[model samples]
Target: MNAEAAIDLLKQVVLFALYVTSPFIVLMLLIGLLTSLAQSVTSIQEQTLTFGPKILGLALLLIVLAPWLLRALTEFASSCITRMAIVAG
Candidate 1:
């Protein structure tokens, strides 16, 4: 493929990755902020406290978003495959 086509594919891949990861990432950020706030209020400065909630929240987010993430990835993959076929043929 030409440089422009390769760059376009790379951009699509990055965007798809960001879309798939956004939920987990945002959840983690929110969880971390809440955990920090809780720690500050309770004076419980435990490292695990921060990690545990974020991990659980991310897990829950993954469970909730799995179907949508799979659909998005599948669509991206299908589009890539179709484009590849067109380019090759």
Candidate 2:
């Protein structure tokens, strides 16, 4: 592939990565914010307190989103593979 095509593929890869990861990232951020707020309000400053909730939240989100995530990932992978074949041949 030419440099332009390669760059476009790279851009797509980056965007896909961001799109797939956004939900998990946003969930973690929200959980962290809530945990911080609660800790501040109650004066309970435990560093490890956030880990449990974050892990649990992520686990729950992963479970709920697994099918959709898998389908999206599979589609992206298939498209990428097809593009690779086209570029190669």
Candidate 3:
């Protein structure tokens, strides 16, 4: 593929990655921030305080969103494969 096409595909790949991971990422950030705030308020500055809640949030998020995430990734992959065939042929 030409440079422009390659760049376009790269952009798409990055955007797709960000879209797919946004929920988990946002959840983790939110949980961490809240944990920090709570720790600050309570003066309990334990380094490990954020991990448990973030992990639990991630697990719950994955459990809830796994199906949709998988579907989106499958569709994107299928689309890329079909486009690849078209470009090749």
Candidate 4:
């Protein structure tokens, strides 16, 4: 592929990555913030206080979103493969 096409593909890859990971990232951020707030209120400054909730939240979200995530991934992969075939031939 030409430089332009390659760059476009790279952009798409980055955007897709961000889209895919956004939910988890957002959840983690909110969980961290809430944990920090709780710790501050309780005057319990434990460094590891945030891990359990974040992990559990992430795991639950992953379970709930697994099917949709898989579908999105499958669609993206198939689209990329199709584009490759078109570019190649």
Q: TM-score for all predictions?
A: 0.87, 0.95, 0.90, 0.92
Prediction 4 global C-alpha lDDT? 0.89
Q: Mind giving the per-residue lDDT tens digits that candidate 3 earns over 1-89?
A: 55665666778889999998888888988999999999999999999989999989899989999899889999999988876654554
Which prediction has more favorable lDDT, 2 or 4?
Answer: 2
Q: Is candidate 3 or candidate 4 better by TM-score?
A: 4
| 2 or 3, greater by TM-score | 2
Model 4, which residues run further than 4 Å from truth?
Answer: 87-89
Evaluated with TM-score, which candidate comes out highest?
A: 2
Candidate 3 to native Cα RMSD, angstroms: 1.4
Against the reference, the lDDT scores of all candidates come to 0.81, 0.93, 0.86, 0.89
- Colliding residue pairs in candidate 4: none
**Candidate 2, number of clashes:** 0
Per-residue lDDT for 4-53 in model 4, tens only? 66666678889999999999999999999999999999999999889999
Candidate 3 wrongly placed segments (more than 4 Å)? 86-89
TM-score of 3: 0.90
Over 2-87, each residue of candidate 1 has an lDDT whose tens digit, in order, gives 66666777788898889788877888888888889999999999898888787777788788888988898889999998767545
Name the lDDT value of residue 36 in candidate 1: 94
Model 2 regions lying over 4 Å from their true place: none
Number of the top-ranking candidate, with lDDT as the measure: 2
